[model samples]
Target: MLKLEDVVEMCRVPHDKKFRLKDHDPGWAGDEDVPKAKRKKFAETLLAESSAELAEAQDRLYAADTWSVLVILQAMDAAGKDGTIKHVMSGVNPQGCQVFSFKQPSTEELDHNFLWRYTKALPERGRIGIFNRSYYEEVLVVRVHPELAQAERIPDAKIEPSFWTDRFEDLNNLERHLSRNGTKVIKFFLNVSKKEQRKRFLKRLNDPTRHWKFSPSDISERGYWDDYMAAYEEAIAATSTKWAPWHVVPADHKWVARAIVAHTIAEAVEGLHSTYPEIGPEKLAAIEAARKQLEAEDSDPD
Candidate 1:
């Protein structure tokens, strides 16, 4: 089995200014020694173990109530982001985990700064918050289709050459602020191959149950694949920092993506070294007194 630590290291994108999406293989599953037939099974086992570890860590996190976690997932269409999230977080306590999927912004959302809506959905201390797609959309989607920015109604100053650079800086600063405030941020860019995406789209088109997921817009968007790729590369290079680095998880194989995501999350929580709160003497005494009363009542005959 591939070590979870090794898997995390393999997937983590370094803070390199010259980072290129082509350098990372979308179909690169670690441990090529494993038979192809068994690769999926191996990933499943790893995911299960990591999920259990994450669950235990979450328990301590909730009891400690000192830190929160924010998981940000960004990916191209048909990258299996939803499936990866469902499988990796299946074991977590729903009460302690919240997921927000950012789609087309509401008029009210567009009126505020790009980060406002996201800030409102941030996890409270001791919980895990997941952003299905996040503020990076401003850079990725809006950058790809500049017309979208017109909706935000920013002044003509937005057309300046430094506009994108400014957005990236804003994102990095927001994450830094979150980190300093006890929110651990984990970002994943599910790197799916264009070829695999096409295959998945075809599958969705053919399957009645999945037809709803297929849209005419999906086909239209594919025409801008290269533009989106360039946007992703630049945004990631600019925003991936020490406080919240992006994990470029190879997502052509759903199993591999799920395993890496589960492991990364578990390792992050475990690294916090958080523990359950200690009881004070007064609280211990109260607990003992309550225990005695309950025991006495149980022994009494009505």
Candidate 2:
């Protein structure tokens, strides 16, 4: 997978000051009509190689106890995030792997600071953790519905502009602290086009296996179109940094998006320099003695 930095670098247009998700005409990804057979072949190759390498790298990560990896994925509805997680992470060892899918806050979750639930889900050292959607929702969703922000118990004076800015600072600081200690953070924004999302939504309603995934409310959210786009653009611009940046992935093609994700994970995992711990001299001698004793016992079994 391309580094989030690389993808953003390639896909964005620098405006007067900040960047946008690129304002291309028909589609953001371009040429979604590429022959399925060709795409399938390319995707198959990437997935196979990446899966093998990911297994090796994660084995080292599990053995070393050196650091943790945090991957946060966010996108609009029908952005293929669930499918992405399911496919991209197929090779990681379950023992060392964890995936968290965040949703609407429960009563208990609603009672605390927005960061409260997120902090508790961070990965332990020597593990890989994934968040399907994370703390950004506090800024994005709440910004759209000002009422929720008020319910957050933040002081009116302390709220307004400080809301998103404060969260960005908190996130940046938290990431820096984690990086200083050992963790690596990677964030992905599955950048599906509005038209493509509509197609996906229609498919969900039309296809049997996917029918359960759709809701009338999903279409309703589309009504807040430009508001969500502004929120996303601001969130991406504010939160992206050297420590932990959000990668805006081209998601019109599921294969391309999945390829990038798998490749990126393999690349990050490979950087850990993890290896199997060496056996001690005492343990080696014990193993030799045990082997000899077992052989002698077998020899006398007649």
Candidate 3:
């Protein structure tokens, strides 16, 4: 099967502002035309293979004993962030990977600096760290609701005029710092259409098992979809630097979305300097002897 990355590169994009993965939502759910059955199987199969590839890549990093990855995902509600993490990362070695989901800030979290929680979660050497929704939220959500923007500690004089500009600058600086420190960061925007979001929202509302997933407040955000898209466009344009280019994954077809994200991650991981620990000769000999003894014991029992 063609990986999601390849398909995304080839997907016939709709007429929604030349909606590239990096700029706009692919609007899959409401897109009755996305060929759901075809996409579902393709997405799952690629996810399975990519999972193995991720493990192998991590093993190489373990041996190499250098470099880690930071994969940041940003999207609106019901944009398949959880599903992507669930299916795409199903095969990676757990010890070598971690996924952090950022939600509404608590009282304690609000008291600290914006990047406090994220700094603690940076991946150790040879591991992969995924942020389900991350530091970017400080800009996105806070921008959407000015009241929430209090978290940004900008100067009172410059706050109103340069709020978003400062955010993009901060984000750009942060990613650059990570790159210099040997952590390769990749940002993904799962672009889904407004129409598709409505379908997903409805599905969550109507289905009993999915009932717990629905939130009435989610609809309130839908009104600002256009505003959010514009925000994303500016964010990507302003911050997608050469060292950390953002890939806009088309989420209308979850398979294509999965494939693209996984492939990109696999490629980045494969490019890293990871390798297994080199066991000494004495340890190798001891293990060989132990294996022979165990084999002999099992044979006698049989």
Candidate 4:
């Protein structure tokens, strides 16, 4: 079976200046041993297996109740964020997993610090929280549109040249704090090709079932594709830390991407060293008493 570690070396973005999206092949599927015709099927099978592993690991995490995990997914439009979340995380117990999709800010959200909205959504210990588009947008989208940054007006504020750099520092500090407090952060950037995005967008327009997903704004956003790419590159480079590193998952093929994502999550949770809580003497005595009562009731046979 192809393990998550098998692909991590290829997918994880190195924390260095040489990290570039153009160097990554969005269509690269794992396991060169598998033939091209059988790769998709094989990857799907791996995804199912990985999901089971993730579910078991998540159960341990929940039972231990000593640690938490946060999975952040970021990508261009039509990059399979929804699909990846659905298929890759399907086997996880819903009680232990929560998913949040960040859209435009509300009036109330605008009133606070940029990170305030997300801070409220952080997962509790012993659970997994997935963010579809997370606080990274403060640097990505806000950087692309400086007008959005103007809304975050500080009292008597002066715009500084290091604004974006400062925001990255804040995010790094936040992740460091979470890590110190037992929340492991895992971030994924679905590396979808521009050509593939166009095809997916067309499919959405041509298919009635997906028509609702198509919007004029989506088309407008395409105009800023290069800008968005640059923003993502810089933001990722600035923030990808050992405590909360970014994985650039090739998303041109949904199956392959899901397999990588599922395995990565399973591996991360498994590495947390969480285990089912050990029963104490008091709990064992209680169990013994319950067992005796049950045996007595059976003997009475009313």
**Using alpha carbons, what is the TM-score of model 3?**
0.83
Sum up the clashes in candidate 2. Answer: 3
lDDT of 3 by residue, 195-267 (tens): 7788889889889999888887799989888778777776666777768777777786676677778877887
Candidate 2 wrong stretches, greater than 4 Å: 1-17, 23-40, 156-159, 294-302
Off by over 4 Å in 4: 1-6, 31-34, 156-161, 298-302
* Candidate 1 stretches greater than 4 Å from native: 1-3, 299-302
In model 3, the Cα lDDT at residue 243 comes to: 80
After superposing candidate 3 on the true structure, give the runs of residues whose Cα lies further than 4 Å from its correct spot.
1-44, 151-157, 285-302
lDDT value for model 4: 0.90
* RMSD of candidate 2 to true structure, Å: 3.6
How does residue 126 of candidate 2 score in lDDT?
A: 83
Name the candidate that leads on lDDT. Answer: 1
Better of 3 and 4 by lDDT: 4
Tens digit per residue, CA lDDT, model 4, 224-250? 999999988888888988898888889
Q: What are the TM-scores, per candidate, against the unseen true structure?
A: 0.95, 0.87, 0.83, 0.94
Ranking by lDDT: 1, 4, 2, 3
What's the TM for model 2? Answer: 0.87
